[model samples]
Target chain A: MELRRFTQPSATKPTHTTVSNSEIAKWNILDRPLTRSREELYLSTFSFLFAEAVQYLQTRVQQVSELEEKLNQLGYRVGQRALELLCFREKLNRREIRLVSILGFIRVQLWKFLFKKSADYLKKVTDREDEYYIEEEEPLVNRYISVPKDFGQLNCAAFMAGIIRGALDSAGFTASVSAHYIHREEKSRLAFTVTIFMIRLDESVMNRERKLAG
Target chain B: MSSSRASTWNKLGDAAYAKSEKVSADLVALTYGSFVREIIKDFEEPDQVNKELEKLGYNIGIRLIEDFLAKSGISNCSSFEESAEIISRVAFKMFLGIRATVSNWNSEHNSCSIIFDENPLAEYVELPPEYTHSLFYSNLLCGVIRGALEMVQIIVECEFVKDQLRGDDTNEINIRFKEMLQEQVPWNDEE
Candidate 1:
């Protein structure tokens, strides 16, 4: 196709014709298929962009919770879309059959899609059957983020938590996901700090899971 | 420009440029392409997606310009030619790890083209046959350039004239200087 055929205006022309309805319909992006099945991005570029995003959010919001909330909101949209696309790609039964199964899907499938690897650990809380833990030694989202001393109790992983919440909620496994920093004194070779994502499913979801299992 | 000034600018560019750790080009390209896809999904309209991507690039550019200035220690360029050279050599090299050539200079020298031999952003990008008439795959680069220049008081109109993904031999961005902005100083009432 000729590059000029796209109807882009010349530098001399200040105004251009608006995209027509038929043109818009023909080029609807959502209707398009994935151009390539698997592709990767530079980790440095991702880190740089993520850092810029955090910096931008910091300038906009005042409180720690607000920052986290903004991050969560950003992640929420990603998670929702990821759930739909991933489910379609995997061809698994639309909704996960059981609670453990959903957690497993998130720990493995979702992690693989987002970070190219399964989460480090997936464990059920010792006393609370409803609470599950998805741990990552260095969450990809937080790999480049370094929370300052003044911003106490603020974890950028809150964005990842929001993603988990969005995915689970959309998949009919309603839950609350929160990220907690786990400081290790031994200091591994990797520079990133560890984080544990805690997911607490709603009572209704648990009941439904039990019912479905029964 | 004087020889001393030219040498000073070159020295600054050299000093400011650092070789950071390398990252997988595939990872960067895929993530950015996916983000563009996500934006398209949100808007559902190709034009809207393009506008949004530009707006997003502008926002990133406004802040990124500060980083560029600080890291490069470049206060200002003597002329549009100088600026174009720096952008193609220093700025692009430092950030994206790619060096673009400034070519196609107009007789008035108000406009030129930055040609990229390799685009990390379009490494794995493919334009589906149906959407060939639309979708500038690397539109974000145009926005970033425009936004960064705007922040530095160099108002320029930028566009992607050629995209390798669309079968162009090289990725080319055409930039035309609109006007040079004059700095305004606030007057004191007492004076």
Candidate 2:
């Protein structure tokens, strides 16, 4: 029993029809700034939201891998949108045509956009022609998440990998991306865990890269 | 006196917000959008999805209230009106970086509407025609409010009355006060 701002759905106009004619319909999303002028929400807000999402996914899937996959798929959707938004915002009129360039973009621009810092390291696997790695000291997604002992080798950073894959795949660089936690017990004094994203490009994509190089 | 109190809450909200660590808004918005879509895919019905979202928000709210109190240092609201003000000006700004306006108080002052033109959760979100009418895109918020208040002995019913994604000019959530829970003997003491 509150006063409505817009007109009520009348006999002449149905509820659905009014949506197309409304002010919201005319608004364009691309015109909006990618970043807000005001300060962003508390980091814990995102952490809590992410935690809820992981817990919800945990109920549906039987295995840890499946849960990670679900998280990745969700992150993939975000990554696709992030790529478009970042590209537009940065005024990068051109898309990366080569695999290496796209990888650099992910390591630098994409990471900066999401985490406000570039990834720690990017290296090609000397043994494999189509494999590469992007390393982070402690990924933002995994910062507060402490995986239970029973769910061994299940890294929440799979979501971050999915984001990377989504960006790469959208840029015409097909790759299978997964996240792994690299144990550094052998090192003398490494305090924090390191997450490495293993990106394996498809043979076809590698072929194209070689032809482009020629 | 009321205006001064409002500004004081705003300052508290701002100070609390500044003290907390922050992340990009788009990251939260996009992740939320993806999560909602996943729920819709799994639930396959708008009503069910709304229910699921609300349930999830409730779980978050109960836990989040402790963090809110500890960080904001906010304590006992003298009245429901003051609580509403804190929720709008302080809580929303502290967590979501947005300020909602409280209005349309009923005669008994037990019910009111919280309105905000901008929602960070709905950033770049365009609801499909099928969902525009049936779905409350941000139904999670209603649950969060209800659950958070419940932790403080305030039982209230919260529901989204209007959603901007549903073609409304702004998002409005109407909250009605229910009976305050009376103190009861602790379960441990009963034994």
Candidate 3:
């Protein structure tokens, strides 16, 4: 696994690749795992801590729409982390191309990586082009929240949505996650529908990747 | 990229449990407390004991995502079935040192019987009746499952059948899935 094996110029290391430009990676010859520069699992642990921080911020946010935008930002950061891991975790042979294909990867591979199960099922709106959803009841991230009247528009789980949005956006898919009003339908039902806008690549980007894969 | 990556679709029941350490609900709660303080500053801590516990579980949901990823060999747990089983065996076992076996599953949702084979966290624990059947820290577990599954668009419901946080009783959880009710549809969609 050459770390440099990425086929896309876009996949090249972003400026945020690591906390410090100076710290270099060390390979563990014995285990053969890519040993991170630091001894701590701080990156992963802190990533979670940051998620909590995002939720904390949403508590006081009065407007749901404003809160959602903020959450999308928060999730964007987390999503970047997810994207890095997802791309690296893949064998690096060929990249996910078609909308359904990338989604399939997300459902099973990415979903498994994050949750333990892929979304319970997959449904697409035939009327909507390039709009797909991993419809779920009872979003795990939002389970404990009882949103108050003051924060009429905000759902703290929007923080998670932000992470998802960020992850998808970085991977070049223009996506946004929204938490729908889940009450009345079923109090126990918590659904987060992710709407991914198809990234209709400029013909050049598509042609380039196809050439690279070939 | 082993030859196995060829088949992206895998039945979760068939996947082998990842060989990793399990996590405990107690540990998850303790960690989530910080999450609450950090995330929801204005939100006063719930007075009701069960709600407080559920709050902690919510924090755990923020975390278990990363934990679930690392311990399960990162990529081996790829398919939905594989992911579900890994969450059941390795993720739960690594954290809780117990396994929740699937009791019933349908086209979408399923239930699992979580027998507390041994509970160090519950070594001398006791819960009042009000909290006995409560989901406790496991609410985040259900939430995480829901979120993770939703990433793939499978709307499902998960609830505890029993509580290990409580004493002397067998425990399990049920997750149900049903048809998506169109908001404007006047008729009952589930029936």
Candidate 4:
């Protein structure tokens, strides 16, 4: 489709009102850079469109896993991109080669984006120096649906898993991100566990880190 | 195939984080695959739609490389091994807060192991009787990891070996790379 340049004389002699730059900026699509201020953005409506997207994909698929995978891939894209942009603008940290350093990034870096609140729970240990847990009383997205019999093989949050996976894969960890449901035996509250499966570093990586650190 | 769009979105996520950009504050983790799932979940015939959704993931994955770099807090990797650590922690951390642990290295250290101690998708999730072998609807993760790793020339297979609730709390998952990698991934190796 050839775009009709605005400068071209309209065959109908231009009936529409002249658009102001501000109006043009206001009409920008999401694919474009964010141009709206805090006030304008909050007032705008995009959920109807988002909701339509969800409904459209849900009905066309065969198995529930395929559908969830699709959502996860899309979410991974968003997560990967977000992580990149955040790192791009900000000063990149020297980086953590050890497990503790990596987990710290998740507890401090990743959790900040997924949950506005820092983990209400964090325990740092020196012995293993490789693990940390970020506690979320409730994973916001899982608030609505319950896993039923036919759809019991569904993880609505694999999209987040993709994000975690993409971020980890790109960062050079060869990490595996998995989502699990952890419902307390006693407590009424439920939490989704997003675990990053860290593998032992290849000798080449350890050597490189040694060289870089040295 | 294009990185521009994904990079642009990554910028949006950055802006959103920086308070300079604003997207809806609502939870967004379920939006992607759920939307795609919803599209094909009800089709009487869905061969074409499945093709398209995967194509969408491919495009998204290419662009994600940039985002992975930006949010990872590292300018570059020192080696393939360091690259692995960055991929696991920073990438996952920026997107969601899951840290996969790497362990059980081969004596020569060419290969290693990872254990999924805390999985977010497992939250409030119970596998139906039919999916007793694994977590339902989480294969996208297996696909996403496969796609990402293949881009870097790492050949791996991922699967769940156990589940805390599903398998008497002896639940475990195993992801092992093939000793040899084919240029082309298998059909099962798609997201």
Highest DockQ model number: 2
iRMS for all predictions?
8.3, 3.0, 16.3, 16.9
Which of candidates 2 and 4 is the stronger one according to DockQ?
2
DockQ of the two-chain complex in candidate 2:
0.36
TM-score of each: 0.60, 0.89, 0.38, 0.37
> What are the chain A TM-scores of the candidates, in order?
0.79, 0.83, 0.58, 0.56
lDDT of 3 by residue, A1-214 (tens): 5765655577564666443211111111223232221111222233344455555555656656766776556555555655565566454566666556766766676555554456654557577554555544544455445567766645565554555556556666665555444433436765444323222324454555566568
- What's the best-to-worst order under TM-score? 2, 1, 3, 4
The best candidate by TM-score is 2
User: Candidate 1: where is the Cα deviation over 4 Å?
Assistant: A1-31, A35-38, A90-95, A185-193, B1-106, B113-143, B146-174, B177-191
Grade the docking of candidate 3: incorrect
lDDT of 4 by residue, A13-47 (tens): 85888654333323323322332212111101123
- Residue-level lDDT of model 4, residues B124-190, one tens digit each, is 2343464444322333344444455656566555544444435433323355656444447566855
* lDDT of each candidate versus the true structure: 0.72, 0.87, 0.47, 0.46
> What proportion of the real contacts between chains A and B does each prediction keep?
0.12, 0.61, 0.02, 0.07
Candidate 2 Cα errors over 4 Å, as ranges = A1-39, A185-188, B184-191
State the lDDT of candidate 2 residue by residue for A1-214, as single tens digits: 4665466757756456444323543466554555543437798889989999999999999999899899889889988888987887688998799888899999999988888789999999999999999999889988789999999999998999999988888888888899998866646675656999999999999999899999
What would the TM-score be for candidate 2 when compared with the true structure? Answer: 0.89
Give the candidate number with the greatest lDDT.
2
Clashes found in each candidate (C-alpha, N, C closer than 3 A): 7, 0, 35, 67
Clashing pairs in 2: none
